[model samples]
Target: MDDDRTRGAGERIADARKARSLSQRQLAENSHVSLSLLRKVEQGSRDATPALVAAVARALTIDVTALTGQPYDLGGRHLDPLHQHIPKLRRALTYWDLPPDGITPRPSAELVRGAEHAADLRRSGNHAQLAALLPALLTETTAAIHTAPAGREREHAYATLTVLLFAAHSVTYKTGYIDLSTLIEERTHWAALASSDPVLGALAAWARTTSLLQAGSYNIGLQLLDRAQADIPTGREPGESVLRMSGALHLRAAMLAARSGDSDLAHDHLGSARRLSTQLGDVDHDGGRYQLAFGPANTGVHVVAAAVELGDGDEAINQASQVRITSDLPKIRACHHYIDLARAYLWTGAKEESLRCLTTAREIAPQQTRHHPTTREVVRMLIRLHHRSNTQLTRMAGWIGHDA
Candidate 1:
């Protein structure tokens, strides 16, 4: 697994292609990717885009993680504390239907506050801190829900647990624990439905799209978002939470549309999200209170992301330049923006600028940067283009499991 960290997706793809007895041309045609680009990626001269990775994974009949080499072995780094919590989390999630015995939950109000704090940790990209918090939080929240009276208190407990599960999902999925993250998603949906809160349900739908995107089920993902939006009622004014979730769904839909090659639909969703964000007026996602962050900044980030997915690097760079990442936005979201910007820059042949973005992303959230697949991809790209060894590039490559 440690060596797996040094290998890029192209190497894995080549191995899989050989295992399947298929040539590069056959893979290109099967995956609907350009032969030249496929050759470059396999030859270690090109970075694998998310859209391309997903397509190739589908064509190879393999998991996207199989190519991306996720849950990367970090070899006892400072971030090892995060992985220590996974077993505990898996146990907690496994006991979702049955709260662990001999545990007395705190009052509902205190539990809600704990859930909020977990959400804050997640939004801030404090993966280790968030992981440290969730095992206890999950136990307490589950116990709290079970012991509460069958009424508002119980419903509130379920909602709080749902938000906590979202935080749990963030740590698990981002750390490459895909199976655990999928379980967390299922628990989240169960809790959300139990809460009977349409807003929470919509948030679950939004969370589920990440898996859909990874699997390249774009149309189904779009349909899920549409259904989520429709389920949230708006007979009266669509309040801030409802509107923000709607905007979040549109942002997700835009990504799905872009990956699906529906450029017009992608832009259309981006436009809708922007309008909703304008209506929300500087939604800083205050501690992720609504369990979904949507604002001008996030909308802008999605615009750049959609452009990148559509293979329009120029558009991605242009949109990213116009958008200001305000102070109140979450570090996780901001870090993701820089990662996408780095990719966009790489596509435009702005190698130095791309490395700058990667460094900025590392500064914003070191743990996230260390584990992100795109960060590794961009680092490899920069390494490939460098005629001479760059100290920073070499160090970054080593940290990200690449041989610089």
Candidate 2:
């Protein structure tokens, strides 16, 4: 293995600190992280958690991706081929206001079906296929919106485009295209508002909170979610769509609260999500119409994720054991659950079990697994723990461009 090139977030953090002329103690104090923990991370003896990375990034006044090394292009055979489609997707998103000349979109019903198929690809974790489909779909949908009549036809076109844009955003964000993802989010909000659907608008707001969470702006993130919930009428006898979107907001809020160290507030948000899930009952599809899954199973997934964010590995494991993850659940969500489990087990000193969970995640969704930062962190930790060579683990590490 090329040890010199095997730099991780910790190495990057250490270098950033040194370049800024800040000592380890000073960096830890400014970031509000424990000095010992920061030292271990810098020495490559520990994994850098998202919370720790975010806190450190804020103190350094750098984007989290700067430390995490996002848009990680190893230019190797193991990286997902989906990166090739990013430029096309960017152009498609850029030309939302200008439909390409001489390109006629399909009929309304056909476009709707295409959009639904795109959503299905996203839910099933077929991101490569979804990425390939986005540029054309974006162009065609934009054309439909441009040429459709001013009344119901235009609204329907905009609605279809909104869902497609959301799916596009999902692919871009997961592949580490943060800037493109932000642009897609902006386009989605515009499309959602133009669609005249309150629920879609709320969905946009829910998605927007992701940026706030990454920036460690927990309080402002909570306020945005609160405003989104208020926009949706949640009085007695609210419809299922409203409940689904509201429940999703709650799940996101739980994540933000947990990362901010407010365990009590995080649990409160999870409780509200549970109540909403009960009211919604079992849904036929993972995401259904809203493109955001919010049922008992999904809520359980959030609980595990929030526990991990709060650094409560035991709670995460306990919650995960009871969460019935069925086949119909979105592959991305199920894959994420396993990723969380891997971390939980690692934190609890079950190194082999943690490796097993990561293997399961790779089996469920190879593309998403390969691109995820946490996957890389866990693999690095596993390598550090097992000084002896293990072929399977080393190969897994190599898949994510980490030579261990």
Candidate 3:
């Protein structure tokens, strides 16, 4: 064992706990480790077992990688050679053709359930589990699409595949395979087109728009968003599903517009989101939030995010304060909200508050908070504030595979 490395790990744990405002006794109680063990680890007197490390990481509201100072890998191998799918997926995304590709009428419950469960895992920030599940899901969804009878049943199959492809995009994006994620996004849009539900097809646009925004193709993304929304009818007021779907698109446009420095356009889109969310009883239905999680709470969070992007940090924080009903949001969305607040706090030089928000976000969705680019930027700022010390800030830098 490397004694020096072990001690450094201990220092990180101690620093992370202090950063979160937890005492040794509190962290011990929270992590369910004995106080003596926690103290020893903190004081560099002992090393933690893998299980102990994981528990402590969770208690500290950080990714296990943070404590371990390693990249996220499944079983330390990261990914099995057999588990590699992104390369194949890149080619398949160009023309998604499932063998025996006919949509089955009345797809088996097991088949439907599998797709839903995979989406659930993706949404819940279970990247490791999702990575294990996605390849199998792709195969099953392909099979389900192939077996379905023509017409509505086949449409359902396409819809299922769309969901699975979107899930693929999500997990892949989180894993840092940005190009592969974009391919999956393309595949999702293709699947959505084959599905009869135009609204669903519009919802699929969310995936591509996100990729475009991340890639800095801001105008193209916003243009596509506009085109997709243009296809949806506004006659006699749209239904809840349409409102949710279109409102979700508009919010994406809002964020993109804000990033591009179009404050009026951003606010216009935001106003649309607020109106739609208000009409839908203030929340997008949790079960079917178009996979985008757009609602009043989420919209407020986005407003803050856009404000942060626009350099209105104080205004962003103020908007964030108005988002009080966070308890009902999806964990991922709640995590995003905190990260946005953290960025805003940092922008305003409110370092302690920013750190608090980051810690809170980690508590909500540690993996997402740890891996997200915005969160990473905030941590970089924190490292600077800590004078690039080998203490707490350096420890956090380790979590994200960075050096202070």
Candidate 4:
């Protein structure tokens, strides 16, 4: 029985590697395991210990149970990408901010490799691991940028730094760790170096505006976005299927203004984005960040959220109901959609419908507290409303460990 089980595990691992289009040697190299070990494991000549199983799992970007065909529940695991690592990053930033001589410069090759590894982790959706490594990665990237020799190397370093900042922002909004102001300042400094490269300027501007908007500085975000849009040179038609940078900037600005209580401004900005999106056809030419500006369910969902914030629950619910959730999309967005619908129902005094929506949201995104900011906010509102009416929101509160 033991032999059969061991062979089955080995076969599964081999199949998974093949399915991922990775050679044994490639898997070995990526996993930091010896080729001999990998071969032995795949051939069923060796039994994988827990450490080896873990190493293989990490290499495959999966949990150990997945390789073993055993069911493992991640129910108790906190799903928030930023929760565990953000604190570590805060500590690392403190350490890095110390006296100049207190820090030791790491090898340039190692720094570059680390940044690449973080990028790979981000792409793999292992955002928790990416967040944990981000502080060290940022420190190394910063050091590399400062010490890099003039020309292409420096440009590469700057590009890497920008990528890291954007990744960090994706995991958390308005976390004090990433200095939005300083990033804008650095962009200005680097802009002088790449004055001839309009694309690089646009990328920097995109990052700056995104960070500012995420930090809730809507006015500053709008100003930066406006400047970026206006500076887009005329008669420079970017090759096919790309929305102009101006349109992209306006789209983001619209979302920011909507979230910041400026409904009129939001509508104006979104109108420009929609018109430009129609003209552009499919993709953003400048950065290719978003393919379709308002095609995704997320676009309508954000509009719903903005409407809800503006006390238009009827409009919010109507819009929220129109969004279609797909398996391919991030689970977080679906979670937001249901929660928004619940809130909309609650505001319109439809308690039973609201509860039903909340239940659905909780099931789809079980670890809602860790994943969605709006989840907790909606729960709190529901609890308060029930409390005022001398009714109990026990089930809703229970989803997030709150007693109502």
Q: lDDT (CA) for every model shown?
A: 0.86, 0.87, 0.70, 0.56
Q: For model 1, name the residue pairs that clash.
A: none
lDDT of 1 by residue, 279-359 (tens): 889755652556677888888888998888888889999999888898877889899999999999998999889999999
Model 4: residues with Cα > 4 Å off, grouped in runs: 1-84, 91-127, 172-217, 232-235, 239-246, 259-261, 279-298, 326-339, 352-373, 385-401
Task: Tell me the tens digit of each residue's lDDT in model 4 across 308-357.
Answer: 65557899888767766655434445565677777678768876777777
TM-score ranking, high to low: 1, 2, 3, 4
User: Which is the winner by TM-score between candidate 2 and candidate 4?
Assistant: 2
The TM-score obtained by model 2 is: 0.96
| TM-score result, candidate 1 | 0.96
Of candidates 4 and 1, the better by TM-score: 1
lDDT per residue as tens, model 2, 1-404: 44433678999999999999999999999999999999999998888998899899999999888888887764654456788888888877777777778889999899999999999999877888999998998898899999998988898899999899889888877877888788887888999889888888888887787777777888998998999889887678888778888888899999999999999999999999999888777652455668988888889989999999999899999999889987767899999999989999989989988999999999998888877888988898899899688988988887778877
- Mind giving the per-residue lDDT tens digits that candidate 3 earns over 1-404? 22322224567788799899988999999977789977865664444443355567768767644665432332332232323655555544544584533433344566667778876777677766777676655765676676678898878778887877887888777655665776777788788899876776787787887666654467898989999898876679677777778878888899888876789999999999998888888654554625667677878887887796666789998988787645556777788778878878876888778878988888887777766656655675566565535455565656545455
| Residue-level error in angstroms, candidate 1, position 285 | 3.1
lDDT of 1: 0.86
Please provide TM-scores, in order, for all candidate models, with all chains considered together: 0.96, 0.96, 0.74, 0.58
